[model samples]
Target: MNKIEIIARRILGWKLNRWDRWYDFEKEQFIPVSEFQPEENIEHAMLIVERLKELGFSYKTNGTSGACFGDVCETGETLAQAITNAAYSVADNSSIDEGWL
Candidate 1:
């Protein structure tokens, strides 16, 4: 893994600022809500999911050809809860609490 990934593994996870608040594991950095999905492609979604997985997050969602809706966790909570927390943090521009990771 890379430095950021290493950082990510060390209780230093990130939550993207994007709509989904997708965390970047490789960089252990947040992307911000603006970078989410203007196009909303599966490739991008999967990319985000991959990063989340590195953070030990998991998800499973059905698709109608190419979309999904599922969970992201290992944090002992629902993905929605995680996202809400993320959104709140983003709204507040607060520092990341890797401790929660």
Candidate 2:
């Protein structure tokens, strides 16, 4: 697996169920609550969410779920692929050294 795939699976708790979605511990369910949403940009948003959590920031979906259709990329990659790419980008751009961990 690529670096992004590792991060998404190990850090973000993404599950592969036809596509990819984050597991919500509070709700004991997945967000977006849909088997498919052609326009959702969940992949990238999930990464951002995890980063915020790491920074001691908190958030709630507030009963709202789903991403904007406009956020979807034209590359035709699945949600999982998108998330993997996002993770790789983050890891590549991060200033923090992995050796610290």
Candidate 3:
């Protein structure tokens, strides 16, 4: 699986269905990634924000399209991308904590 897929499964707790669509454990159904594209969809991107909060991180997005979570920070051309990058950072850190990185 790609990095995003890995993060979606390991960190975001999603599963890949037999049809190659993603199964959201919380939602309990397979959904198209495009419809739930966190990098472009605000509603889905909020999932990352919630996850950050659950991980005990306070975050903020500046007018310059930058997002910061403690020591992990990233900038993107758009707010969604910035949030998505933050998710990736969190997943990477989590992997390190679990000694899988």
lDDT of each: 0.38, 0.43, 0.72
Writing each residue's lDDT as its tens digit, candidate 1 over 1-101 gives 33223322333345434444547565666654445431333443454445445655544533232222133222213443333333223223236455544
Where is model 3 poorest over a 10-residue stretch in terms of lDDT?
Answer: 92-101
TM-score of each: 0.32, 0.29, 0.78
- For TM-score, candidate 1 versus 2, the one ahead is 1
lDDT of 3: 0.72
TM-score for candidate 2: 0.29
lDDT of 2 by residue, 6-70 (tens): 44444455554334554645347674424322224564556555653574434343223321222
- Native-to-model Cα distance after best TM-score fit, residue 87 in candidate 2, in Å: 2.9
Q: Please name the candidate that would achieve the greatest TM-score relative to the true structure.
A: 3
| Candidate 3: stretches off by over 4 Å | 99-101
